[model samples]
Target: MHNDPSNENGILHSWQQNAEAWTNTVRDGLIESRRLVTDRAIVDAVLDGQPRSVLDLGCGEGWLVRALATRGIQAVGVDAVPALIARASERGGEFQVASYEDIAAGRLPLRVDALVCNFALLGKESAERLVASLPSLLSEDGRFVVQTVHPLVACGEQAYVDGWRQEGWTGFGTAFPSPAPWYFRTLASWVGLFAETGWHLCEMREPLHPETGRPASVIFILQRH
Candidate 1:
């Protein structure tokens, strides 16, 4: 498999070593916390009983995949880390241990009605490669929905304290502490990425807190042309 120097051995090795504990912590936290608005919006948009097949990319621990399956959608989850895939499979979701680049090369066995990527695609080159592959992975008119750390937060241009708040979650608590090169762009950048990848941008939303009404995330929906 081709490897990018920025995302090579160290990052993967770190995740592999700590994957079990990391996945459990993440899973427990998400299960207890209230749903993020962006997550709800993504689910509302695509879980309309139409798209039977769905692929959850970078599906760590498969929470979203299981949620989709509970709604009767045929969902499969895939991630590069072996431990994460093992946990996902234990949850009754089909999980594959492979990167998006690997899957794009025909490593996976099935295509789907839609693709969902949730806070999973980071790093500039990797995101670009995955965005470039979405069109071919979907059925005609297939939809793609993604939730990511808002560009402002990820880029360090905007702080999480300014809007959405996570009290105890330290930014650098992950197994990998150093930041990888991330492409956290404004709306135009997102549109451009989809356009360059041959997918048409359909809708965009900046989800906000229900009470404070402060912007928390940006969600994008794209349709295969």
Candidate 2:
């Protein structure tokens, strides 16, 4: 298995390659973690803030965007993968294809009440750039919400620290040829990054799987300091 996990562009390339299978898996609700817990965890997190408008930073296939729209909130989506953006657009709401570099460069010029990244922060440089630029992308009091794989649980046999980590999707499905690797950060690292980026962690929630009762994902609710 080839995981170009360390390179930022290589990570996007991997997502592009797996876009179809990923879309299928997401739409068909094949991923057990998402189906049972994390999906609702993200949606409810955003709704709890009661933001009039939301920007889903790495929204794939637009499920979260559509879900928010049903509650009468305007939702927009941006993603690097063309296929993923197309799939999201077809489903509904405003969906755009823009790389994190473009967005970080101030190309995305809409400030909303809330900015969200649902499992979208993947690469080291890319994630850093986007988070650092978030203040400009959000309204004066806009909040930022993020959902990611729980660092401790995801650390597996590796040392519990910050680095690039790769995981195969064999448990999810056999259709994926090359799974995209994600940058991993510890709990303290995450809070430090947010502070360094001019944001403070407001709330942290761990969404657990119903059956196993282990955390499926970790949510960080943040606000500009």
Quote each prediction's TM-score. 0.80, 0.95
Residue 144 error for model 2, in Å? 0.2
Task: State in Å the error of residue 219, model 2.
Answer: 0.3
**Clashing pairs for predicted structure model 1, backbone only:** none
Model 2 alpha-carbon miss at residue 113, Å: 0.5
Residue 164, model 2: Cα distance from true site in angstroms: 1.2
Off by over 4 Å in 2: 1-6
Per lDDT, the best of the predicted structures is: 2
Residue 115 lDDT, candidate 2, scale 0-100 = 94
TM-score of 2: 0.95
Number of colliding residue pairs in model 1: 0
lDDT of 1: 0.68
Model 2 lDDT, full chain set: 0.88
